[model samples]
Target: MSHTPAPSRYDRQPYRRSGRSGLLLPTLSLGLWHNFGDVDRHDTAREMLLGAFDRGITHFDLANNYGPPPGSAEVTMGRVLREDLAAYRDELIISTKAGYRMNPGPYGEWGSRKYLLASLDASLKRLGLPYVDIFYSHRPDPDTPLEETMGALDQAVRSGRALYVGLSNYSAAQTREASAILRRLGTPCVIHQPRYSMLDRHVEGGLLDVLAEEGIGCIAFSPLAQGLLTEKYLASIPADSRAAKGGFLKPTDITPGRLAALRGLKELADARGQTLAQLALSWVLRQPVMTSILVGASRLAQIDDALGIIAAAPLNDAELAAIDAALALENATT
Candidate 1:
């Protein structure tokens, strides 16, 4: 490994402290939920990751089952880590989750002490690192006792496998339950990664409130709503869009009414001299606890475009009202 980093391969983006925590994550963090896997272009992944780092995106998020074949994304990240960012490991915040399926067996998935602890160790080995900046429980497992699940995360921190622990896709109430356990165990329950976008106001159902009340940080994932909130879907699902993909996004989900709302949102974006993707990201990031907006990029340009959103001004009263009207239309049919 080189003694120094590769001549600053990334630009520095704005940084915000995740809640009141000492950690300052980049305003826009990268997630390996899709397209960083086995079949996706390796150069694209490398360039995007490098571009993000050059732009000061220090935090990178991943899960055990992120790759198309499962675990390939982490392997690829590991390769990148060794090849490019090895010297700068101390400055990066790399995180991985384990609640989702990684194997077929009954104990292969879910939030158990056994599964999370084992999964983190596997992730660490694949990343070629002694420890991760943060480790998250991918989801709430109703079958497993929250205590046991929470204990798993607590163990990760105490065992020196992960510096801090986080929760993902967990509801406000469930977050409290798990958070309570982790806090009692003396583990730093630092953040939560949740899906939040204009099309998905599910967080308003109390998740954000709980995070706020607890002083825990939150990174809103899929801030583009899987690209549906972007201008790319205004006309029709482009063959290259997520909608065009056979899974995750369905054609039926993009109804005429939804398209109209999208159009209105796009129009709003155009009026502001910004793209819909930027607008959607700025909207959700307006919240205080909105520590970082987790984004996925298939190209360096897309990542740059998202980074430009940091310059976006806060939405005013009129913009908020207009957005509410658009959401009303969506509620009627959604």
Candidate 2:
């Protein structure tokens, strides 16, 4: 079946400028890190993509090694584009990264020019696009010089493989240096992708400050903290939950103290007439440096719940204080 995007898609959602760049990204971006893979149903993936676009999510983030087998998410996205979104190609912000391992070998991973450029080509082929809107160096490679990595990003744009370049999982110092190199090369780092949430506040110590000072956009991945911030693990881990599946998140990660914090946060969310996920997302976006939040959905309803935060009110000072208080308990136990 052919899919048609709704005409009223862009009416409600607002787009934020990516740092000092000319590119504008929807406040909510969809990530194809989990469900859009060969192991998942194609029709359901297609529905999630279409549903996201219908709700005004124009940015779709992917990585070279997202799938369990690797690169399958991009193939799934390619099919969705060919089947449904080809006509609206110019209206979307498609992004992919290459710094993680895509194949087994020395040249398979890292920020080396060889790996970054070759990975971009592979990603483009899988995505069925001539160029990605934003190409990211998925993580900083300590083994490679910063100049070499930044130069690869610069060359990616210069060669017309990517329009803009970004850095992911880089520390504040690394981002500052990378941004300087990209700036000197005349392709300023447009954004930074980091794992940030109430549970993970490493970025707040200095990375957020660096982004603010350098005028770089910040898009948080894992804003839901691997479903720990959601209602899924309130009582017991669902059989289908990520924690139960045991990869990135484990059953042991959720202790009684963390659950207590979640319960407290959930009550606050309920008082505010929003879900815990919504509250967590809103908290991440409260920072001005946050250009958007990347969320992964197993179902269309999850996407809907995430997009619903766009219309919800921002968290005020009192609410923030309450959240910090609840988090303080989790921290104390840790």
Candidate 3:
């Protein structure tokens, strides 16, 4: 069956220009890091993809090793692209990354030129795309030269495998160095994807400043701290929750103090008529350089909740101070 996108899709969502670039991304971009794997329900994944686009989420983020089996997420997205989103390809900003273990060989992973280029080919094949909008380094490889990694990124654009290139999980220093190299190569780094949230503020230490200086937009992943910022873990971790799954977020991560902090945040969110998740997202968006937030959703309702935050008022000085106090209380209690 052909999919008919909502006519009002562009009316509700706001777009932000990716620093110094002609690209404009929706405030909320859907990430396929989870819940679109072969093990997941195809129907649900299909619904979420189409639903997100219908709500004006034009950007979709993916990586070479996103699924449990690695690369399966791209395969799932490939199906959606072919079956449902083929007509809207021009309206979409699909991106994929390489820099993790996808195979067991000398060139299977890392930022090497050979690996990065090969991974892009494989990702393009899996995603069934001639080229991706943005191809990322995924993570910095300490063992590889930055030039080799970034050169491959430049080559990706020049070779027509990617329209633009980006970096993810790189330190402030690494990002600076990589950006310089890409600039010299004449393919300026357009965006940086970092793990950021109220709970994880490592980006503030220097990364954000580097991005601002380099004219690279930032799209934060895990803005809800991998679900910790939500009310789902305020009391106890549900069996179906990602924390219980024991990968990135562990059950032991939810301590008594953390729960207390979540409760405090929940109270603040209630006062604003927002969910804990929305409040967390709002806090992350407070940064002027934060171009977008990459969100993952297992269900349609989660997407709805995230989209709702776009209209919520920005955090004022008092609210920001209160959030800091709530977080500080966690440190005191911990």
| Per-model TM-score versus the true fold | 0.95, 0.98, 0.99
- Candidate 1 deviant stretches above 4 angstroms: 1-11, 331-334
Q: What is the C-alpha lDDT of each candidate?
A: 0.85, 0.93, 0.93
lDDT of 2 by residue, 235-275 (tens): 89899889999989999999988998999999999998899
Model 2 ranges off by over 4 Å: 332-334
Which candidate, 1 or 3, would have the higher lDDT against the true structure? 3
Candidate 3: the clashing residue pairs are none
Better of 2 and 3 by TM-score: 3
Q: TM-score winner among the candidates?
A: 3
Candidate 3 residue-wise lDDT, 77-173, digit = tens: 9999999889889999999999989889899998999999999999999999999999999999999989899999999999999999999999999
| RMSD per model, one decimal | 2.0, 1.0, 0.7
Worst 10 residues of 3 by lDDT: 325-334
Ranking by TM-score: 3, 2, 1
Give the alpha carbon lDDT tens digit for every residue of 37-153 in model 1. Answer: 999888789888877787788899999899887898998899889988897898899999998889788879998888888888898888899999999999999899999988888
Residue 109 of model 3: what lDDT? Answer: 92
Candidate 1's displacement at residue 118, Å, is 1.1
